[model samples]
Target: SVILFLNKVVISQVICKALLVPINPLFVCSRHIRNRYKRISASKMESATEPGESVAGKSTAMTAGQKKEDRMKRFRELHLKRNEARKLNHQEMVEEDKRLKLPSNWEAKKARMEWELQEGEKKNDCLARGEDYERVKLLEVSAEDAERWERKKKKKNPDPGFSGYAEAQLRQYHRLTKQIRPDMEEYEKQREACGEDFHPTTNSLIHGTHVPSKQGIDRMVEDVSEKQIEKRAKYSRRRAYNDDADIDYINERNAKFNKKAERFYGKYTAEIKQNLERGTAV
Candidate 1:
């Protein structure tokens, strides 16, 4: 019984020793480091909260007058900042204007005008001496005038040489004597069969017919001449307004006309005048 008890005791001690033995040194070190970090974090938290509490207490203790003064100081600082920014912007704008501004071209224009005046005087002197103006005017001839001159020259001399002239004349003769097409000949015969008594509207029902109409050049010329004469008469009437006698005559005539109008529509005029006085007339 004593040996059995001793063996059991040895077995219990061995189990307890095995349990107490360190499995890993790193795990023991990590646990110790974590506990230290926790204590330090708690102390840091307390320190941080202390300053925040003091700021809260100070802000709560501030008076209304002190708050107003602080607000005014902030506003003044903002205004000064804005003024400085504006001055910087204005300075930049002025610098940009100076850099981009163009110099005037008036001197160049004056020089050109003086040169043109001298050329004009030279041309006038040449004209007075009966010299040919063609050479002097060559520089001033525009593309339009040159084209017009070429067209006029071509019209005056269509065929430049004898061979060209002969060919053109032959072509003209052939065009005049050209044989008519069968269709056109048939059309002409059908037209003749219709007779002068047949109305164009009735003939058009079968086949369309185009008749040449006169342009009436004389009538157009007469109309234009009449318009020009009327325009001159109108101008004369307008010019007469500048004369004292004509003005007096016109005023007298207008006065007489107004009197006639007043007699004819006296009642309507009186009503209009009354409405105008009352500010009711449009």
Candidate 2:
């Protein structure tokens, strides 16, 4: 009986030790992992809170009154900058206007005359060399076609009667005379000043007409050819005068925008000041 009781007690003790040994280490490791995760989370929370606290403190230090004053100061500074920029741009535009003279209508007319003279010379050369008239014919056809197209495109109602024809003739005459009137007047004045003593060269005279010498004619031709070549090169490469006009237009547009901006800035500043005085500024 005593031997059986001792065996039973020892068996029970061995069973309890086998179950607890496996479970004890697993529980201890799980608790240690949980504690490590808690520490990491606590550190992250502290790091995030520190910056937030500092920002809150700073914001609290800056009162509503101080913020309003700062905004007003910034508004004034912005207007001052706008005014300065406008003034500087105006000064620059004034200097540019002084430096670059815009081409007038008279200058454009002169250029047109020079171009026409060159074209006349080309046509004369072609005819003098006895070249085929195909190119000339083509040019004439093209000009006629362009004129026809223009006439067709612009449908102007013509007036019936001699009044319309007379008005058109008068308009054409005025247009032709506009440029030469000043030149003709100047020449008349010069002739009058010279008086009756001035003897104009005539083809039929007692000493005969003084014709240009061969050397003088050649020199004149050379000068004319050089001028034609220069003009051809200038127009063929690019219209530099047109580019100048475009630059002037862009500068003027920019100056106008700057002026508008200055006006807007002034108006905005005035409104803000009025609001502040009434204690209604945001």
Top of the candidates by TM-score = 2
Prediction RMSDs, each to the true structure: 32.7, 27.0
Regions of model 1 farther than 4 Å from truth: 1-22, 63-282
Q: How do all models score by TM-score?
A: 0.17, 0.19
Reference-based TM-score, model 2? 0.19
Q: What TM-score, to 2 decimals, does candidate 1 have?
A: 0.17
Instruction: Give lDDT tens digits, candidate 2, residues 2-63.
Output: 46545655655577687763334455456556877899899999998999999988887777
**Candidate 1 local lDDT, 24-84, one digit each (tens):** 5455456556877999999999998999999888887776669889999999999999999
Screening candidate 1 with a backbone cut-off below 3 angstroms (N, C-alpha, C), the clashing residue pairs are: none
Model 1 lDDT at residue 182? 42
Best by lDDT: 1
